[model samples]
Target: MKIRFPMRASVAACALCAATTLAPASPVAALGPTGGGPGAIVRPEATVPQPAVLYGEGTQVRLRSGAHAVPDVTALSWVVADAASGEVLAAHDAHRRLPPASTLKTLFALTALPAFPGGIRHTVSAKELLGIGEGSSLVGVVEGHTYQVADLWRGVFLNSGNDAVHVLAALNGGWEHTARQMEDKARSLGALDTTVVSPDGYDADGQDSSAYDLAVFGRAGLRDPDFARYCSTARAAFPGTEGTFQIANTNRLLTGADGVAPYPGLIGIKNGYTTNAGNTLVAAAHRSGRTLVVTVMHPQAGGHAVYEEARALLDWGFAAAGHVDPVGSLDALRPVPRGATTGAKPKTAVVASTGAPRPAEPDWTQTGTIAGAAGLGAGVLLLGLRFRYKRASRA
Candidate 1:
């Protein structure tokens, strides 16, 4: 069963153009919060670390007496958190802003998904395909082909299709409008680090997100029944000019493609890579009725380091759940209540936090058994079935 939402159309007129031609790649100067020297980033109040400790440059974790050490990785930034409670198990530079690459699609889906339902079909117009970046990934969307909204989302999730994103963005109003909506949505979700210059998440100047914000996007996306279905879809037949073609999910952990073994109880979220944002990933899995979300960004080591590090973090997260206390929170910040005439500093809601002191150097060798939230799968399936029945009855 699949579910979709109603989309508002705000089509802009433009002469039909040719399908996007791949152009020669030029080096993109890294230019965002990350390009600034260290300490250059001035975070929004919403993006500030909930617990003071999350501000540290090194790994942050508070383990109980018996808890094993967290797996060490070379990720520039990463976060592991419970999807249900919003408890951050551990993180390193979680709020340090950096390029997000295609993983920013999670935020895109969060913003635009509900407006375009699965059953609604749109005919692809050449105008809608304009402005895709040179050297961008595509899922082979062709002009004049009519496709279900669901099909386009499959292309987005499985192929990281920037073309599909542009078409959908056009439908949502236009590329710029969709980008604005994504930015607004990010702020609403307390993802203050994100700056959306391209709705498709093609690298643009000043566009970046932190591991904390990406995990926040992933956790929030999984809560939506439609989003859960789309992200979790492993493979599907995509509508094409010739006919339907098969597209498999690019998330290595979910599909076990490219020698990365399929993670047990793994559920899809998103993955991304570019010359700048090397191998960013956001993954969630369910085990023993608990759901865990992990985000890894720009590991220093090249070649599958992102996925391996994410997997290792997941292992440590599940194993450390009961043993380690939450160091911070993924909860969005809210206005702190203030008295009209009081001269006192304002404070946001008190987030759950507890942890032991960090070791001088993490013991990466500590091994532990672990595992995802099972309830969400059941809920998503039931919601999809009910929505499918309703749509069928209407048909």
Candidate 2:
């Protein structure tokens, strides 16, 4: 379908004129202690802090004895999940809120990609590029030009371009509208920690997502054929006056940049970095016909920690695929107006956690692969902590 996107100049002017808008805030008093029953959503986490492995409320990864060579990455939050089943194999600080950087684009793709056909073309305006913040990753586009929806998407996936995302958002309506829609999509996917504010994932105050939520995004994005194709693209090119502007995929796991061996089953997802967010990544890999998705967020700087950390998790997930038990499965979100769909599984509720440090064990009692808990001044909710409202842009 052919759709008209907003003029760049007008969009830029609107961006400049904007004031700080508050997020959808929930009443602190209305939130009860963490725990849920049938029809409840649960997000799990570790109460006692672990330095390396994920220690949240969900099931733990079971590595075969003498099979543990995974590096301890400095990333603050990360999760490894089986792609087909959405089962979380292992995670560290999986539910902690952290800057998402470009990985949030996976969410945008989930919400916006299937809306526009690949061949659709739109004019580019100088003003549109202005809407992207300074130091934001860009897929170079000239103002007063035109390009196809596919090209814009290529820019987004290959280069982590804020410019490409802005143009696409304009096609969806505007930044404000697209942001709200992306967040709504996050809700439907059972990504409770995500509060999207920018479609391109530019770092913004109050913009945040958890490692587990990112895995949710990757899983949902991969389900769409177009999203999977775009992310897996190893290289893409855009038309330009001087010449064809070509770029390699930013995902090193796919392209093998920085000397890291290209993973055999690496699939494209997305990756991002900013001062606040450090390095973040969402990647999926297939091995022996089994697919797994790994999300690593806020890794400490220096080497390719984001990619390496993700690589380690992927290796472990493939090795541990069937041998160990799943601590939890990332639930497909129940359709809103809960149970509206026939045979849709009811959102399961989790009982409140003790909120104390303890040894990690199978989450048999947590109820249904426990996921989110609401904030009560720092008390950990055992599972889905559904907040009434409140409110990812790049870093």
Candidate 3:
């Protein structure tokens, strides 16, 4: 189905103006418990505090004995983490960088989710329909097809579609803007080692990430309800097309009826493969109410081998830890050392120097008022000019 997207100048202008107006308010709403604005949250400690029993001498020996070993995994690296607690269950070259292939699309989908309006209908442009010819997979989105933003998300996760990624990038702004946004989003999410050069991971230079970073991205992506729904689909119909396109999930474990044995609670995640980065898989599984995420890159065998290794690691985790919750209540644990007492009256600040009161300086309200008036005047003049131009063209 062909779709034509009509870009109305007035609508675009209004959207830009609205975004500019609301941008400042966003930071205020992101404030933390300390009442500091966005980006002011206290940094997490570098090392987790281990229990005295666990930290005692020779405890490291016990940890080594309990470590799970992966088989047929040739990747320079791998990482398995607890989804709930964010604990590293296993690591083999986890920090080593490797091409993520379509797995990078997971980051792209997540970073763009907040920018897109839910349930909004967007027409696919001709430029977005053309797929990169670099041997990457595509969902066959044709030019001039109108679809909801939600459907584009399905294309990204279900089919690992490069074309769907392009459409999403265009929807956000463009390739350059989308790439920068992806980097910023990754940094904000604390995936410090990640770098995204392309919206679709198509073997582009500098477009690589570590297995550890991919696992982090997967965990964050799974948190979104829409993203989880799209990735978990065994099959879905692509709307606005001639025939219903059957999308088989790339994760093979989702295909089998018997739910990947030994693992017992495998949930859908993502898979990727390329010459530079051998078969890569990010698998998530749940058992006894605890969820674990495993990432394998450049596996010795195919994708299935990686899945089997992940299943083994998950089994070991469940057997050993037995669903120990990682997080604890801050209030129940310890309190900050600030002078203000908990639930106490606000303390008044006393100036050390004794001096006569000076007249308060003139407030800047008048200057601000003048600036606001000038800005309003300029907006009115621009609108008048646009209206006049439209009227003249109509005449």
Candidate 4:
């Protein structure tokens, strides 16, 4: 079955395989993984200040009188922004890069989730499960067990399992390929502060992200239905060798586990902890049709600080909306034109809740050819695997 690309498409459809993917450089494409070489797309330089003037080292918020001040917390980096309008309400060291821990999985899910359909089943191989980080969390996915793609995703969200991530990466090609794709996706989203050294968000020597970039990920993930569902799920049944077992989400604020009081209207994005990264969280909540996303990274207060800080920010954001102007924006920086003259500065456009000329839409005719062909190739491979999986199941 052939797929047709709709004009003004949010995602592109490949003619060769009945599938759609982020169509090249579309706005949605900028938010997810694409089928392209790691360096195929030119990105803004990391040093280039995004949302202009967001590089300031201290807190950035213009509070009017009678509005309570944002809570003082020990987070090294944090940001709170309007999800729909992309207006950053307040931020502190928003661009400061720090270790990301498992929170990097948000980017991973954005990149890899669309590549596999949930009903597709993949058998775990010993080799596929190899190279999981030592001391990393596991979902107890035994080798030789076959799992519906959905089950593995549950393992990832609920248990933060590196083993499940490895299996999914193997399906997407391999760890290195998925990591490179993640890097490409991050740049596409204008998350310039993140460096993807590991696809599973394990603490590698240089893997890192910043509050601004992480909030960007959370906002983008909400655009996808599957990404939203998986993260918000509080519990799920994961298949194991012995039997199916229940796993609860590690996001304390979402599940109200670990003595943390659940925040009303909380939406699960992700949470992470590692010796190097400390505690990191990306959380979103909706009240009165307005949604806010918050990112807290490497808080010094320890235990529950990440969740509490995020909760406090959300409260402040909802109340502070319209009372304050955006400190910055979450809009992705425009990519350099493919063959622009060397050293030409890329245009820095900011999308705010206030009226501003939005960035120009990418010319799909010019860019879609390459992305469509790439999507076609990926679609074929995935379809073949699905057919094989079905045949094996029926045998």
Candidate maximizing TM-score: 4
lDDT, candidate 4, 1-395, per-residue tens: 64533332322333433334443444322332336655354343332124765779889886776777888989999998887767788899999999999999999999999999999988888999888888898888888999999999988888999999999999998999999999899898888999999888888998888999999888888877888889889988888787888899999999999799998988788998888998999998878877788999998896788888888888899999667767788874635454434332232111123223245556667566757677677667567656766766697
Off by over 4 Å in 1: 1-49, 332-395
lDDT of each: 0.79, 0.73, 0.65, 0.81
Give the alpha carbon lDDT tens digit for every residue of 329-384 in model 1. Answer: 77634222332232322221121222221112322232111001233444455566
Of candidate 1, the 10-residue stretch with the lowest lDDT total is 10-19
**Model 3 segments more than 4 A misplaced:** 1-72, 257-263, 322-395
Q: Compared with the true structure, what per-residue lDDT tens digits does model 3 show for residues 202-228? A: 787887887767887877766777767
Candidate 3, which ten residues in sequence have the lowest lDDT sum? 348-357
Instruction: Give the TM-scores of the predictions, in the order they appear.
Output: 0.72, 0.70, 0.64, 0.74
Which residue pairs show backbone clashes in model 3?
2-144, 3-144, 3-145
Ranking by lDDT: 4, 1, 2, 3
Worst 10 residues of 2 by lDDT: 348-357
**Which ranges in model 4 have alpha carbons more than 4 Å from their true place?**
1-50, 332-357, 361-395
Poorest 10 consecutive residues by lDDT, candidate 4: 344-353
